[model samples]
Structure formats: C-alpha cells, structure tokens
Target: MRGQEMEHVLEAEGLGKRYGARWALRDCALRLPTGRIAALVGPNGSGKTTLLHLAVGLLRPDAGAVRVFGETPYENTTALADIGFVAQNTPVYRDFTADELVRMGGKVNRRWDATLARTRLAQAGIPPHTPAGKLSGGQRAQVALALALAKRPRLLLLDEPVASLDPLARREFLQSLMGSVAESGTTVLLSSHILADLERSCDFLVVLQAGQVHLTGAVEDIVAAHQQLVGPRHHGEPIDGVATVVRARHTDRQSTLVVRTDGPVTDPAWTVHELSLEDLILAYLAGSDTQSNHEAWGVAA
Candidate 1:
C-alpha cells in the first residue's frame, strides 16, 4: 500500500535488526491504527524491545522502515514531537525532586503540559519535594509516567513500563495508562511479559515468536478464530478443515488439540472450547513443538 493512503498510526514493514551475527528481530510488519492500545507480547528473546525502540526512533531497522503519523520517526523532529516514550529504564535525574522534574519537562520538550504532570502526581499522592532516587520502584514508575503524559503526545510507546511494580502497583499503573488514553484519545503501544496485564488493558494484541510475528489483530477476533479441540487419537491424516493445530495432547483413548481455526467447529466427534488470553499466549510461546507424537501446526498468514 502507498504510504499516503495508509491510515495506520504506526507502520513497520519487513523490519529486521541484528547485532554482529545474532538476529534481534526479523520480518516484522505492523499496521497499528489510531487511538487504540496494542500489546507487543513475546517470550524473553522475541525482540519486543527491539521493535519498540525502532518504532520510537531510538533505533533504526537494518532491512525495513517504520513510520509514525505518516513520517519517518528517526530524526524527524515533528514526528518525535508527537510521540511520548517511556523506556524500560526511565530517563530521570536521581537527585531531582518531582518539582524539579516538572521544571525540566518545561525546559526540554516543546509540547510539555505542566498542569497535567502536576495533576497526575497529585492524584498519585506523590509529593513534589521527594527526591526521585528515594522513591519506591512503583512510585518511580508513576513519576516517569507522569512526565511522559506531560508531553500530551499523540502516541505513547512504553517498553516494559510495569516490570518492577508489585501487583497492586501494577494494577494502578495500568489503570492510570488506560485512564489517560480514554481521556485524551492517545494511541498506545506497550510491551509487557505479563499476559494478564495485557489481556485486561489492551484491545489489540501482537504476538512475536523467534523474531517473527505469529499473530496481530483485535483481541476479540483472535479469540474467536482459535479453539481447543478434544477427540479420539488418529493416524497420519491432517484434520479435515482446521486452520492450524497449535498443540496436541493424547491419552490412550483420546487426543486433544488446541487449534486456530477459521470460523468455528461443526464436527460432532470433536468438542470445541474457547481459549482464554493466557491460553492463546501459551500456544504462541510453545511455538510448534515437534517433540510431541501428536501434530502441532501453525497456518501461514
């Protein structure tokens, strides 16, 4: 598709990155729409952070291109102005107080909204006089979020933003992020290892496995297209019309499989069960396990 005709807020086409001979990301493609939260999910080595860094202009792709708001993100001042990024390790002055941090935002970013920063800090019960380094990990995360929101950005790119928080704090942080998106129509792309967090907070999901995109779409649509099937064991014939057998299990009399099928099940011999977000996530992580005597497959997109 032509760049000007695309409606995506963020676009990546055949993106790849490598360090020496080790591949960090490969064949990555995304067309993210506006005003929605997208979860960049994967296992530890699956390149979520690499994709995010490229999207935010902190890193460049070796083989492809990324565009944000119809323009290249790297070194594009106007595009950068519209993006707010909170890296895994937030950029903060350890010795600075909340008040000083707010002031720093004013002096640095052209789009800074001092009022929003202050209001968020106040709501979180974070004292302006507290030194940034002295705050708890959760508190520090909140402060970083406040600063990011202070820019009033059109898009927010967060890389493992809640990694260090406790359950309660993580909940609060996610709530805050969702609230901000609802209030301002911000487009958010966040990466997280926590499946439950993404399931609850994001409407759109992307699953990356071994540097390739396994699936990407609305959460509801993905759930609807996948199912767990249970039936008696069989020999070498492929399932009649199933999309892809994601995983399989067997007892002496029965064989059960998780499959991503087009539409739904109609056969009487097999029973279909809806998959949870967590189940879907695990299916992707297991990634075509061949050791099982049963067949596990992935349909090509």
Candidate 2:
C-alpha cells in the first residue's frame, strides 16, 4: 500500500521510543492515506514531536517499526527525498536568505524544484535577499515551507509550524500551506496545539494521549460515529447495541454523554446531538486509557 501513489503514504505498527526508562511513544500505530491533511494532536508530554521525528528518520524507534513509502527511513536517502519536515518555531538557517536557502536545497536534494521555490516566495512577498532570521515569523515560515515544497516531496511532515505566530500570521501560513498541497497533491501530517485551526484545515485525525495513540480515522467518520446525549441524570450505563459512552458528566438534573453510536439514537429519554471536530477530539483525549498509558510508559498506576 505504501508503494503506490494512491495508497497509504505512511504506515507505522507497534512504533515506540524512549528516554532513559520513560517511554515517549508506546505501541503507536496508524496509517496515513495519500493526499489527506491529517492532524496529529496530544497534550504537552504525549509524544507528538517524538512520533514526527521517528517518521521522518530524525530519530529511530527503540522498538517496533515505522515505514515511509514502504522503507525504513533512518539514513535512507531515497525515501527521505520524498518526505519534507518543518519543525517547531519554523527553524531555519538564520544567516541564509530565501534565495540562498533555495540554492542550498537544490545542491542537496536531487529533485529540487527551484522554480516552485522562487515562485512561492515571490507570491508571498518575501524579500529574496533578506536573511530568514530578520524576516517576520510568517515570512520565515513561508520560506521554510517553500524550501520543503520546492523539493516536490510526496509526503510533508509539519510539527507545530504556526504555534508562535499571531492569529493573522497563523492563518496566512496555513492558507499558503493548503494552497501548495492542493496544487501538488502532497499528503500532509500536521501537529499543532491549536485545535480550532486544525478543524479548519485537517480532514483526518490522529489523537495521542499519555504517549499512545488513542484514535485515528477520517475526520468526518469520527465526528459522525460519535454523538452527544443529554438527559435526566443517571448512572452512566452502557446503551447496549446502540452507543458506547466515550465521555460523560452530570449535574443534579442532567447527564451529558458523548458516545460512539451504531445507529440513530432511539431512546426517547436522551437528546442526541452531533459533535464538532474540536469537541470530539477533546472527548477522546480526555477519555483515553491513561491507566494503560501509565503502564506502557513506566509511570506508576
């Protein structure tokens, strides 16, 4: 599946990583199909960055495996050529101008698309000779993205590329990214803490919690399968053959639940409603199996 352009672009099974006795990622598994803009989300210590590093071959797994285009990417130049990564704070060579950076990329990557790089930067109004360090946060990020995209990578890995920008800058960065990917049909895996921004851009979801993947699927399927119910307060009971509660909370007179439903909710006692992508992501993250995560990561139960 990973070999074909129309199939899964990235695949991982039982992927894991560690720091001393702490497991940064544990038994992580997911498949990213081609041309999907997938969001990878989790709280601060849940291994989001670790997972991206592993996929891009910046770090090797301590156990299990990860494959990009069906090859282990650690030092695999051929596979690495097809993947591009932009890290947190949009790190770039501060001393290098956008033009210089493009030249550097052309020298290093065999498939570099210099025209695409120059065109994108020009459209974004980036000064060609300004050192990237002196450019605004948004411009520097745009330059980094252009460099990555100009390589014509099949899969792009972005790790919180807009986390530091102001709201307008953030929006512009995303718009530029979406525009380029749309034009090129590049598969994207983006990790960021801004859920609202993700909802607007990503169509697939990967939620991690306490160092393990808690959910993964197309965004629409996930939002549709999960429903919210509100009704008279009661012990959270399983709605057999109908819904499995993912999260629940109650007041004295009401119980509210988010459940994975099998069909139309027929129970007259409950009021069913749909969840937004942000709400659904929050529910799964809040309701994830932390006890198991504790065991997997060597934390006390």
Candidate 3:
C-alpha cells in the first residue's frame, strides 16, 4: 500500500493566513493522497487548526491557495461537499438529540447515510434520544464523528478530536475512527498533540512549526530518511550525505544531531540510531525556530 499511487485528496500551495500583526501560517504546503490516514503534528499555536480551516474553506487563505480533489475549496460547493470536518470542540446543538443530529446531517449533505450514522451511534452505546449537550465528552465526540461519517465524504478533517477525552475514551474513539476509515476508504487528515495515538493511527505525517511546514511525507519514508547521530563534540560542520540538519545538541564531550538524508550514514565515528515518530516530531519542533525552504518529501502534490 505504501508504494501504490493514489490521487491527491488535499493540496496546499504556498498557503498563508494572518491575524492582523501575526501570521498564523506562512508558506505552508502539503499533499494528502487518498486512502491514507495522515497525522498533522505541531505544538500549540503552530497553525495546525489554521491549516485545517483553510483546507475546509472555513477560513480563506491570505496568500496562495488550497484545493480539494483538484478543485479550489472556497465557495465551491462540489469541493465543500467532498469534505467533512469536525472542529476541536466537537460542537453539537445542546437541545438536539442524537437522532436529530443525524437527521440534520441528512438534510445538509447530499450523500448522507442515515443508517450508517444510526449504526455507529448504537455501536458506541449512545442512545438515539439523548440530547447532544447531555452526552459525555466521549459520547459527544462519537456523535460528532458519526455525523461526519454519515456524510460519506471523500476527505474527513478532524482537529484535535480526542483532546478532551480520557484514555479509555480516546482508545474507543480512535478505534471507531479507524474502523470507519477502513470500511469507507475515506482519506483522513487529523490534527492532535497525542503522539502515541498518532503513532498508532497514522501512516502519513505532516509537521508544522512556527507557521511553516517542517516535514510532510509517508511516515515510513520519513523515518527511513532521517537518523540520529551522537558523537564527540567538535566544530559544528555540515556532514556529507546529510540533506538537512533537523536538530542538533552539543555537550563538552558529545554532540548529537538529527538529520534528514537520502542514503545511509557511512561514518563510523558517530553512533547512528533510529528515531520513533515521537522522537522525529520533537526534533523537528525543537528546531522550529530555524528558517529554511519548504520541501514535501515522499508524496508530491
């Protein structure tokens, strides 16, 4: 599946957004292919939410453009209809029952599947007549997700969907989510701070930091392309075969650097180690302050 060619479901080119004096996102770009679960990782205020909004047309870009399935999203009904988005808060009407929300989804979306929504709610143990506001955080999230899934959208966007749930609830929510994705083959772009969950749920990764795209690619390719090296401290000179130095640390006797490269590290002086998703993410986030040209590695737009 990793080598299979798929259509690009979402594409952002030189995207930017600003709030008066501050640019929340700038020169950001990424391509999410169909049929893969992509994790969007960044620290607070790194513009994860901003980027999601831009993709869904909830907010327009101040620069560049974003497209969904090759069409611009803003005010484009076809493009909008292809996407289902659940915000960070997992919003639902307080007075509306779970059944009503499902009905509402049917009314709003041309392709809504009422049976799917009902079945998902039942599977989650959420009663049909329970008012959304009366539901627990986990239940609310489930309902929100059900509503999104019922739309039968080609692309689903979730922003920190499990941030407020407990560990058990988080597990259940993600399980339901992955199950839905598997059955529907929907392309998903999810943003969250839960590294462990992301590591388990996603195959593709996009790391944003300080308003820029630091890394974007298939998780497997990204991991294979980067390595962590620890060795004796010396003048910080560039290493051959290393494409980009993601992060570096130096002590009196030892130096450590996380680097992106296309080939193996042949030097014997440095101890090379593999990096987990969490390790790679943190290393990129730690180097967020540095400036460089944006590059989308494994998957091209």
lDDT of 2 by residue, 1-301 (tens): 4246348888899999999999999999989999999999998889999999999999999989999888898888998999999988888899999999999999999999999999999999999998999999989989989988988999999999998889998999999999989988999999998999999999999999988998899998998898888888969566643567888888989988888988888878988888998998888888865687689999898
TM-score, every prediction: 0.92, 0.93, 0.92
**After aligning candidate 3 to the native by TM-score, how far in Å is the CA of 41 from where it should be?**
0.7
Return whichever of 1 and 3 wins on lDDT. 3
Better of 2 and 3 by TM-score: 2
In candidate 1, where is summed lDDT lowest over 10 consecutive residues? 292-301
In model 2, the Cα lDDT at residue 49 comes to: 97
Which residue runs does candidate 3 get wrong by more than 4 Å? 1-6, 290-301
Clashing pairs in 1: none
Q: Indicate which candidate wins on TM-score.
A: 2
Clashing pairs in 2: none
RMSD, model 3, all Cα superposed? 6.6
